[model samples]
Target: MLVSKYFKLNRSQATLDFLDIHIDKDIPVFVDPTSLRSLKTEWGHHCVSLLQNYFSCVLSAIRKGDDERAKTLLSCLNERNEFHLGYSKKKSRGHALGPASADEIWKSLSKSKAATTGLLTDLEDAVLFVDGVGPDMLSDAVCNIIRGPLIEYTQNACLYYEIPMEKEVSSGPVWNAHLERWEQSLIELPLARGAPIILIPKVVVRAKQSYNSNEYYRHYLMPVLQKHHKDTNSSLVHVLKGKKNKGEKRVYKTDLYELYGADKLASAKLTVAHPSALTNYRDAKKSTQAPPLDHTALAKLENIPNPDFPALLNEATKLRPGSKDAYLYEDAIEKFISGFLYPSLSFPVKQDGIHDGRKRIDITYVNSAKSGFFEWLSRHYAASHIFVECKNYGKEVGNPEVDQLAGRFSPSRGQVGILIARSVADKNLLLQRCKDTAADGRGFIIFLDDIDLRELIGQRYDVISGDSNHLLYKRFKALIS
Candidate 1:
């Protein structure tokens, strides 16, 4: 069963910030390090830093000929089955890189031309030159290195959804960027069928890694070989008969492939000779965008449907204000935002305490917007975090509620918030009060009533088809204007 279904969270994969992984089997996805470097969010940058530090340590150990330390470092990268990712055929029995394999990899790196020439920078680069190290192994190693951040993300997701977790679970080997080594911690984690599972963010996971040996061989290596064959007039070139022209020549790409098979060592040798090819490849990968998986793609992967916003909204509206079930409204809003504004906002935390744990925001999300209004907010208002306050009040929301959300904002945490209320007796009154908060230099607060939320939900289909009129953009403009 999927994690959401198992926990009865009443959520679909589309509405979740983290992947709703199967409890017993593995999913065919990977955490691409190149994708991590492509992210614009603070969280992404932090993860990239961790990756850099860990790999730097490995490189240093190999360079200094510290065989014992290098072996110890690589040994920490056991298959991380808890993530329920990779190509595990049936049940997720983790495939460990045993002592012998570790030694093999260590020796390969030690004697590697790519490593000696500074071409192997990140773990993903190992796929290009190192024998037997494929995307799955590199991804597993990355998972071990950044396990700390993943653990924190999982814990926060659990807290947001009220998922049950076991206390004092071993955190596995997490990379310590400061100490330049791996460390384990005892912390709370959600367990499935008596085994602990780590939640991976949907934004970070990919159907295939951006960095691939095949891609390097084809796009980078083959092109260089093509130029070489053309310059040398090698046998791989073909002279073709044209309709008008007397002579025309072309190269049989397939013949070139047959001549030089897709071998990593051969490609590495070519790269070493024409180092610019490697530089160009790195630049191209850096420039290419690695967009987060959309709702449809995520749904298809998990074999689930995208969220039914209208039905979800109806369920939330049915709950009575000030009742025991009133919290469901907050949960519903979180689901709605996560479903719609993903890749813009992610990793939502519930009851996020600030001011030394004295004040609690209802929901907080990392402002990970690559485009649209949230991106604008990040550029202009310093919205590193998106604060939300859910008020399930039966009547109109006034100054106090607006003040509460605005109070949660700061230059550091972000200066924008959204106040979600059941209904507003006077929409203009709430808007004016929110304006007053902005005018006072406290923060920007946008008020959304149930009716307005319903309007947003009603536009779901249009938005999904890429015909969005940018409703949130209009709402923010209305607030500031």
Candidate 2:
């Protein structure tokens, strides 16, 4: 529904069909009717249902490029909001209120009270904080914060990414140097108010810097900038940034950016940029200066159709276009059971997904902390292993499925039928049967997509590795030797 309204597409047909397969719908989508707080896990991530809204918001901003407005919209968003977006200054009746002037707006959105406050009395009186970062040729992922939201300004003064909220902040010599160099770097830029992104191949990240600094750079700074490129997801990048200030010895570590092509970092096609540092360099009064506006792409993003929640749910069951249906959803249950709860049961997902696999599996990885596969046989099959069954349908596997697994296994190798289903409603009786049978044996209905699978395992292909033995390590380590 929100997607259709913002992107100006027909709501019913506007599916998030990114990949080729029609069954790829398991990639999380945002469901608006629900809120984030209700579904937040112990880890505080938004529920899986809200992922679609998150994508909608980000996509809306990028495609529409209402630079100033987008900055305001994105800053105020958080996991608490279920990542549900559609925030625009136009809808805020209080946006024009006078009691709170622009002076207070910037401070409110500062490192502590991070959120986009729509009212800015004097956008011209802003100072864009930055470091002397060039293209990614230097920092790699180390100083990714510096390589921010896609920019148009080049003479090195690119249109910097907006500081959403100060999820975290650090201050010190090592950190203070980067910030100082950044502030100092800002003294030379043309824009003053917004956090205009500047690039330094190596921003000189300081590990010994305050934890506040590390958290800020990692969560807010990196995530904000990285959201620009989809490939940046899952990069557990470690910094190899600039040397310390004069007193500290210059560490000579190779930055990861050197490995990237400059062509990839180029994206002037989107937003605007301005690189002229404060020409009146020595004046502290200059942080109030503003750059001329590039009035070229100021048109508000056109509205598109957002999907209706009822239809989306119905479609996932029908196994239509982009429908994960039930197969992928069920496998996610196995991953969560095996990886998080039951280490013994945890294993990588099968790319081809699961059927009632009559034979052996294609891929299997063993955890090192546990014993080997052969050891399972020695333990007399008492190991907490269960046979997995992933069903991509609306109906439950019922007592029949449970009995089928029970029939196959001997007492030494006890078996449980982990039947995964899409909607829990249809599986009601079957699930009860599994529970009742638990006393005699262990078999249960996982009812997969009843909850968001992506919120459990992931949205992409994740593989598990079993080569944990010391001998295996020595053999692999020998290659380096």
Candidate 3:
């Protein structure tokens, strides 16, 4: 009665489905709070403390007419400028007042009472005195320095911290940009760019009303204060609340303990725990050990054939010339891989290219197999992830196609990839190019054609019977080698 059936889930869809379930169920994800806290302390609080201390010393030296000591302190500030705080506009370069410009600013500051002035005011004056510079640039730099660590800290909090929700978690953006945007928008306000923003999820704060407010406070805000209380002891806690005017927002100020109070601050504690962390937490926690993957289950998946393979292939071939259904081909290839190969693979994340936005990889697999031919290949190539590119063109894939997949390979992203095409007319030539790339240490590329795909799919009956000799994986290994 059923006309046809297709492979059910692709790597990308599977990952999203998993995340959706996890979030919807309100599963607790954990992060290494200690390491994250240390990083925050170093970058967010300690960095600011050192800057303020150096600035105070510089001011003291200048006031006593000790130019040499003042210059020395100024030099210390210049040295710290190496870790500039602006966005990377061109590769690694950012808009920061370099050592030379910093010296110029310090020289001007020393000539006036600006050295003794408020930190933000002094920095603003220096920026104004410098030619061809603006507050935006300086603000970006300062905020980047302070907020950079906080961003990482906030990410950890969001990943691990649990908030009780009555309804299913909304399918929204992974990160609640409310805090990030609020902190960034502060630069445009009367506050300094280096102002610290405590990242408390709106959900957690709102949930405080449902239960004991102290529980929420002890769980969320206490760790932050314990790590950073010294540096920000006298600093006010700034919370961004409702809009002030059209396209503008207001920051509500409060004391450190006023929001939750210091009653249970000391007793509030968090420890590293499992099943309360992001999926990636396991990868981080066990750097040496590969995350567990059900090899038996994945192997069993190959036994199931998509009855609609013939129909799907026919439909693929009949696709109109220059049809926008290129994505259809992508989906087909993804399905083929899932059914014919491993089922534990992770993604072609919704965002085309998870790493580089400019380029989009057709398919990506986080080699999740523990022990198998694919796992062996992963270990051989030292790749934790594998990239696949599918081209449904009526003609043979060329050098440019090979180059595209090769370009995506990197040590971090696994220096191996696969190219799936309708056919490669000049098979020998294409293989030669792949060999050249491998010889050049660029990456290893395995080319798969329509016939190869069908062969793999056709063997499902044998695989299901446990009689097939894993010819698909063997052939792939031979081709790559």
- Candidate with maximal TM-score: 1
Whole-model lDDT values for every prediction: 0.80, 0.27, 0.43
Q: lDDT tens string, model 1, 1-481?
A: 9999899987788678888899999888888897787666677888899988888888889888898999998888776578888889799865445566788888888877787677778878888888878877777777778888889888878987789999998888888889888788899999888899999888888888777788888888788777887788888777777777546656666876777666777677668887877787888888875777777777787788766777767766878886576677888778777776677788888888888999999889887766666767778886998898888888878877887898888888789888888887788888888888888889988787778888877665443343437566566677677
lDDT (tens digit, per residue) of candidate 2 on 154-250: 1121211111222122211011211211121222222112222222211111112111222323333333334333344334333445575433222
* Clash totals, every prediction: 0, 52, 5
How do the candidates rank by TM-score, highest first?
1, 3, 2
Off by over 4 Å in 3: 1-323, 354-356, 459-481
TM-score of 1: 0.88
Q: Provide the lowest-lDDT 10-residue window in model 1.
A: 459-468
Q: Residue by residue across 1-481, what tens digits does model 3's lDDT show?
A: 0001111222222112122111111111111111122222223244344334433555666677777655544342221211222233322233444556556655665543324332222232233223323433443333333333434433343232221112221211111122211122211111012222223111111100111224433444444444444444433434345576443322222344564344321112121121122223324333433222223322232233323555545545555423377777776556556434433354333225655588888877665544455556665775677788878776767889888888888887788777877776787788788777787888888777777666756765444333426654554455557
Error of 3 at 337 (Å): 2.3
Write down the TM-score of every candidate: 0.88, 0.22, 0.38
**Comparison by TM-score, 1 against 2, better one:** 1
Best by lDDT: 1
Ranking by lDDT: 1, 3, 2
